[model samples]
Target chain A: MSAQSEFDREIALDAADGEPGTYRGQLGEGWRIGGGINGGLLLALAGHALRRELGETSADGIPGHSDPMAISAYYLTPGVPGAVTVRTDTVRRGRAVSTGQASLVQEDETGREVERVRVLATYGDLAAVDGDATTTATPPQLPDPEACVSAAQAPPQFLKHATLLERLDLRLDPATTGWAVGKPSGNGVIRGWFRMADGREPDPLLLLLAVDALPPVAFELGLPGWTPTLELTAHVRCRPAPGWLRVNLTSRTLSGGYLEEDAEVWDSEGRLVALSRQLARATSPRR
Target chain B: MSAQSEFDREIALDAADGEPGTYRGQLGEGWRIGGGINGGLLLALAGHALRRELGETSADGIPGHSDPMAISAYYLTPGVPGAVTVRTDTVRRGRAVSTGQASLVQEDETGREVERVRVLATYGDLAAVDGDATTTATPPQLPDPEACVSAAQAPPQFLKHATLLERLDLRLDPATTGWAVGKPSGNGVIRGWFRMADGREPDPLLLLLAVDALPPVAFELGLPGWTPTLELTAHVRCRPAPGWLRVNLTSRTLSGGYLEEDAEVWDSEGRLVALSRQLARATSPRR
Candidate 1:
């Protein structure tokens, strides 16, 4: 078995100091839209950095509470492609859960340190928890990967330059991919399959990307252009098993040119891995 | 008009210094579950403090971004009843949006400072925005407040001591409030009407409480007991009009003893005023 894959290499960050929570890394080229890197990718990087810092060092003699229960990030500024620093502070540590904050920073054009993203997350050891377990929510019925349309094919002109989209094997359920061709379903729902292009084992961090991988569901409402996310919060219920993650994204309200997206990520095991909601602005397609 | 109503008196916090961002206050008696105070009320306090700090004073020549766009809080510790300090720090100041962090702190039994809650929020100026305005989501149908059952009456024994519940007049939609009588609707949806008991105007802060005011929808799914939330994030779409806020709360999944709740608050004007999603654990009732 290979020790490391390109997917891991692209997302990995090295600790800047002997200190455990301070790390520095740069996003790969072409892994961006306009001047900013993908929000999901940035979230994943921050989640990974946080997991490395808090989870691995739990004093309970247990390996880690690598299970990400909840995480939210605010896109404070545009994260340009360059060396970025991630600093995490473990805020509180308890028996069953831990809380921390991670900030993603980088220097801007004038060489001033610009904070790009601020993320707060919580981790929990499910084994330590006691409660009733049940799920009434079912995964959306979707076409098998082999039968779906790959987002990589027939890309919209605006997204043609987003090579990062190619790294994730994203296939849209044919019925929901109509917006790509200018014909929207108008139902404001999108279903698809998301898996790492390199086929790495699925983990909590990967689930973060899967939830945000899809374009805003509002695009189907005939609203054009890039929808920039203002804030995103994701909840991870449990560790996911390996296999393609099924994504169901829905927009409940599109008001004042602002929309809120709700998403669910279900693993092949039929287990709900993560739930996410984001607030974003629907900027019309450039005239 | 009275300078302070009982509802406002309970939720209000005094600024600690001439400094606009710092505050000192205490959660009112009977406003807790177990030893911790209510998360919704904590969020409301932070939002009020933030709005007071950012909105009341804007050098932009325009008013402050009193319109809260998004806010997320991580419960780090059980916020016990005590004199607590809330410190706010402005993270970023922009023309249209401002981001900040608020920390709710208290001294523990050992006299050590414990950070009970950490919140990050973003504010916007709706007046500064332009574009298509519309709301595709509609409020759920419900009986008039007079026809509905007040959550105030027939209180669940577990919440009998909660005085906070009395401050907020929450009436349930008859169709979904069956859980109170031990009937599981098995639908996992709860509809209700929420307004300040003292008849205060329905503002963004009060909407925060309204979103979380309902008992966990899972309770109606045969999942018994307190469902303690681990993290909650709310998006205030626009300033709400004066009147009772209509609330719709739904849970898409309850898996691995965890659940995610999505809530929408519509003002009497039928406009979407706030959107929220929460991640929580479903701890069953004691045997």
Candidate 2:
């Protein structure tokens, strides 16, 4: 619509010359959470490569199976901004759904290619997914977007390195931002509203990014520092409608030096759009 | 200790003659949900192979990284009871964790080996996992194992085909089993206690099976019939203390003919031992 949003530009892939299944992409700047790129952005990059490898049509010549229904990724190493390659492998091409695996590899300081993330995803037509539709989980109650605290208002030290916040309109619920001022709720829940700054409509692919867009829920537990995600799985339930999306992230248990964060995303129409769960290493605030 | 339990026997893998990464195993009878083997059993089989491939030691020669911390599986096809081969591939061997990929291949009716399940998992030492542990979610309230209705008391039609029930001591809370009597709770939840009939202790690998052992939560929503799992991810948080593990399954949303089932498994110590989330298709009862 407007020369492709920044998100599209960043995740764009060019066909590689040597391999049919390999594609080249660039990790754009301003997406670092700390020393590495955000995990969701890396997942979206691989999802893009997987979609390209699977093509727009299924083996049955049907126009379905074009969207990633569920994708699980394991972060092998932190990703740095630079040139990266995504290698895709088609596992199966069924009539109803198609499955593919993708790996995002980047070169290290020694010029050795290191795998940053490995993913397995299934693609399907969300529109064709018809049957009973019911929702027992409701959207988290929150004030209007304009009434919430903007990411720019976060602690300067945190906002300094998390430049990715500048690219999105992230408004945090004031109740959940207590940790920013040293008064955490201790409930391990983070609720916020997410929308791309460039006004791009969120699709299944973007939902991947939206699922992990929130700051680590551990922050709400007063356990600061970076909580690196080891593995994440996102399920795109349906296509979302345009407008700001409501996101709620919760950590039910924190045990064994690791915690599992679960996210539920609801679209403007109040319909659940995507759900995700990630396992991450828990870290305590620096003494 | 008594002899090996039925589960260990069914999931036992023998070294393949030729390849170093290949192993032979059999899908023992009784673990069938409908026409095929249970998804959890298949996952356990692959996890066993992954543990073998990654070995018991890490690259640092440390005696850790043996348990599966997180494992995700995609069900390719329904597996019948028969001989199956598990092909394992070591993706990486890090100091704290090791990653591996495995595929369970079985002979189809056409005599061609077809991949039944493809899994990507990361293994680590549960005992070595130490950190500031905190949990806000409490275990589900339910009657004692002896007070709950046993799997043997289920509808004869379902019990006849689900021989897997006989192998485990599954006692479902009466409130959530209304679908068996044509009175649906309309709230998608099922709580139960799980244990092996032979009194086998529950380990991380066994927790994989325990995660998906319960009947579909869709049953509580008046939905009947088989709910095949499309993708499942299980996270083992900590080791369990022997006895019956408390399992709670819930379906928060059923949209577009697909529903997500999230499970929280608490051990006898009341500690959260494992967490799992699965995507499955919802089916309505026959007219």
Candidate 3:
């Protein structure tokens, strides 16, 4: 089998029980980021768990919805590779919108279960709603995807250990990737085309990971380092078409060691799929 | 007492319990918008409750933080005037940051409890951490406060019943308030100076409401009406100095009857007090 299938199989979860709403999954070695798993992957895992729980028969007399309209996740502890469990609670099941909360936990060395992530999501049927206005906002103008430099072509020696990079194909816009050449733009913006490494179709859950998968926008502001998210909230406006996603991220200010990152994702068909905002630590890079 | 003083008294919450973390408050007559209490005031009420809970001695061994780092609120239902209770749960108490969740619930007609609002907040000491960088973002440029038209001098007939307006004083930037005169610039931006109507000092809690106090940005797009928030997330960066706050709100896309509003609040000293983004319904106004 190919590496893409292997990565997908490792991330796929299995339902353990339907009554109390539980799922069992594991973070394979491919999802590792440094000593722990990626935060966006964990969020997607919880979102997938919630999707399964809500996909069931009507809970609280409200039918299950398919698209996630809003999702907020809080990271309490770094996730480890091992047996993991996800428990979901259906907060309210309304006709137009439904809300749910999920907790991702794993066993510690003492055999005690510890919570690693907590997320709340709201899902609704986007097609059912009538359109009030058409979008005048166009996708970010960029060079042809085929003409751009793919992150998969030549892995930098510094990022050799970043196994997560192997799961996604990122075509960085040559104009915005100046940081790769050590010439920071100082214009807090990053734009690029992104898609699954395995040529898999993009979905709402995949969009979640794609939003944060890019290098921190702070890198362009002369700050080179990992900026961990304190909290991230995303709003899904429409379902994505089957193709590459155009993403643009920017920050207006970086003050007091904290900065807010705003991101927008547009599908290949020129449709806005999701918008997200995250408050993260802007740690000074140690060179 | 002036109407401003009366409005403040109505929204002020009282600590109902010294332990277990509970607050009792009421939404009075002046706080109404249409038929329900204003959502911004509700957020402020919850923020106040969280501030009070965190201000007490360390709970669960976590040190008491001084300012709100991030807050997210989901409006489950329209709030009604009566006795409302806010119960807080300390999720985790760390040395630098603490996490907590609060549920704003009220008793229904049958005496059964119903949750009207849910919020999660993170609190930390802004002064404890050393500054790594400075912001290049300047506060929204507007005319002096004394030269602008105050929302208090005259109440428009459409907003005559909106008593919540009496509690907060708004000096509209002449360039952005053209919607009041049946003309719009179609720029999708609003800038103004805001403070409590009763001359009350703007605290972290007040900053929460101030972020959403202005008219929805959708009005500029020729869609005039009530645009309610589905979800709003805010990050408080610094302890706001006592003075007027300069605010600017903008929207990038309005599609499929939904739009996201982004706002920034800067204190008179040019310090960014808060940054917020909200997903709200873009409903058309009835002609």
- Prediction-by-prediction clash tally: 0, 0, 0
Per-residue lDDT tens digits for candidate 2, residues B163-192, read: 888889999999888988988798999999
lDDT score for residue B25 of model 2: 91
lDDT tens readout by residue for model 1, B1-287 = 23486546656778786866798877767667533677888888888778777776556565566767899989877777778888888788777688888898889889999888899999887653332345568777889999998877744675664566767788888888777787878888888898878888877677777777776787777776777788999988777878888899898677667787888888887777888888877785743
TM-score of chain B of 2: 0.95
User: How displaced is residue B279 in candidate 3, in Å?
Assistant: 0.6
lDDT of candidate model 1 versus the reference: 0.79
Candidates sorted by DockQ, descending order? 2, 1, 3
On residues A1-287, what C-alpha lDDT tens digit does candidate 3 reach at each position?
23256445665778885547888988877776544677778888888888887766593566778777888887777788788899888877777777788888999999999888778788777775433345666788889988876766533642664577788888878777777778878888888899878887777877778777777788777777667787888888887778899999888777777888888899887877889998888775544
Model 2 per-residue lDDT tens digits across residues A63-118: 53668888999999999889999999988888778888998999998999999999
Best by TM-score: 2
TM-score of 2: 0.96
Ranking by TM-score: 2, 1, 3
Looking at model 2, give its docking quality level: medium
- The prediction achieving the highest DockQ against the true structure is 2
- Who wins the lDDT comparison? 2
Query: On a 0 to 1 TM-score scale, where does candidate 1 land against the true structure?
Result: 0.93
Candidate DockQ values, in order, are: 0.54, 0.63, 0.52
